[model samples]
Target: MKLRISHETTYGYDQPIRNLVQSLRLTPSIFEGQKTHDWRIEIPGGIRGPGFRDGAGDWVEGWTLRGPAEEVSVRISGHVETRDTAGVLRGHREMIHPLAYLRSTHATAPDKALREAAMSLETTGDHLELAHGLSALIAAAIAFRPGVTETHTTAAEAFALGQGVCQDHAHALITVARLRELPARYVSGYLHSTADGQAHEAAHAWAEIHVGNLGWVGFDAANRCCPDERYVRLGSGLDASDAAPIRGVAMGTGAERLAIRVQVEEMEQ
Candidate 1:
């Protein structure tokens, strides 16, 4: 399948900022499952800095804006051809060891409820089955409801609330997977909506677990399935903050407000 994506993020400030620096992970992953065709990141009047691929095999690009300006915009447009690998991440080069993901970040730390949820699942000593079971359990546990949680909502808090968006499901899944001693990380990406007419928010989030010989396999509890051709992976990290598509700092005390617009659609081949 071929997919086209357009994303724009705008930042507004009450007062002009002295300077702004941002690290972007907006490019799609280079793996067996997907191939990039045309991709570009544009920041009007911003200086582009050097970019590099990290140990986790995701491209990180830097940008700077010397601003006495009240607004900054980042726009990304791209097309990618994707194949179904049945959620298995293959041919992606990375230097990090799977065990490294076992360590929990603040956003994905397991609490009593999460730990209990992980422990209650029946396991057959089969890593693949265990992973799927966990994904299903999480999907059943949490109802997918937007506007119920914020970006900083922790996995434990979302679990207790029993409702959240994809980010919450991804964080909660990662937390529970770690509690089960499985290496897991958060995945940030875009997903084309299914034909069922279910509406989704701008971007998407999922959990990837290391299943012995399978490397990293994606599980999206929010959608109750593994990633397929509809998914375009961008990056992976211990949690959402670490894998954020855009992370930056504005050098002034000016209050900032943000607005984002994203569209992911299936394109005819």
Candidate 2:
């Protein structure tokens, strides 16, 4: 399948910002499951900085905006050909060892409930099965409800509430996967489907666990399935903040509001 994506983020500030520095990980991944074409980024009146690939094989670019800027817009458009490899990440070059992901982040910290949930799963020594079970458990435990959690909401918090969006489900699953010693990381990407009645945000998130033989395989607890052709992976990190598509700081005390639009549509192959 071929997918076209359009994403625009606009920030409106009550007071003019002195400067804005943004680091973007909006580019698609290079792997057997997907190939990107005609990708572009536009930031009017902004200076583009150096771009490079990070340790986890995701592309990163820097942008800077000058003073007295009341509003800023960052736009991205791209096309990607995607294929399903049964959720296995293949042909992607990366330097980080899988063990690095075993380290837990604040957002993914497992609590007593999460630990107990992981401990209750039937263990057959199959990491893949265990991973699937972990995802299933999260989906069953947490109902997908937006606006109930914040960006910094932790896995333990969401599990306690039993209600959250996709990020919470992914975070919960990641926490439990780590409890079982399965290396897990957060994945930020796009999903082209909304028919499942799950959280289908234009920007989607999931978890990937490293099995002994299959390597990193995606599991989206919110959707209750592995990522497939409809998925366009962007990047991965210890948690959502680390894997954020846009990370920026405005050098002023001005309060800011944001407007974002995203569309992921299927195209004729």
Candidate 3:
């Protein structure tokens, strides 16, 4: 299947500022189950972009702006071809080691509930089965509540509320898996559902556990299934902050408000 994606981010500030820097992880990566035919990223103003690959081998882009401007806008558009491997991403290649995913920044530390969930995780024989079971548990456990959790919400908080968006769900799942000594990574991307159907909050996130034979296998705890062709993987890291599609700081007098738009669709070629 062929997919087309368009994403736009706009920041409106009350006053003009001097400097701004942002890290962007908006480019899709090539894995075992998916292939990248073409992709690109664009910035309108004083922004520079390429591809930023972290120490963990996750590819992203860091942007910086230094000028007397109040508002900034960034756009990313691309197209790719994908296929479903029955949720099995066999031969998936990752440059970084699995243990690399365990390390987390101060902002993404797991909370009490997340720690408890981690302690409760008993290793089943099959990793795939464990992932599936966890996915079902999360779907059944949590209700999709908007504005309940912010970008910085911890896994414990999300688990306690039992209601969160994709970011929260992915964080909870990762904490649980990490406690069991499993190497799990955070995935950021776009989910292409029918426009007339229920709308998505914005961007999407999922979890991928590293299996010995399979390498990296993706599981969508929010949707309770593995990633399919409708899911276009952009980048991945240890937590949501690490893999955020757009993150940056700008120098301004008042404050800056950001608006984001993402549209993903299936296209016939």
How many angstroms is residue 50 displaced in model 1 relative to the true structure, after the best TM-score fit? 0.6
Taking the tens digit of each residue's C-alpha lDDT, what string does model 1 give over 1-269?
A: 99889999999999999899999999999999999988999999899999999999999999999978899999999899999999999999999999999999999978888988999988779988999999999999999999999989999999999999999999999988888899999999998884355655479989999999999999999989999998999999999999999999999888999999999887887
Cα lDDT tens digits for candidate 2, 10-54: 999999999999999999999999999999998988999999999
Better of 2 and 3 by TM-score: 2
TM-score of each: 0.98, 0.97, 0.88
Model 3 lDDT, full chain set: 0.74
- Candidate 2 local lDDT, residue 118: 91
Q: Which of candidates 1 and 2 reaches a greater TM-score?
A: 1
Model 3, 137-246: lDDT tens per residue? 66776777778888787777778889998888788788777766678888888777622356554678888887667767788878877888777787787888777777
- Please report the TM-score between candidate 1 and the true structure: 0.98
Lowest summed lDDT window (length 10), candidate 2: 194-203
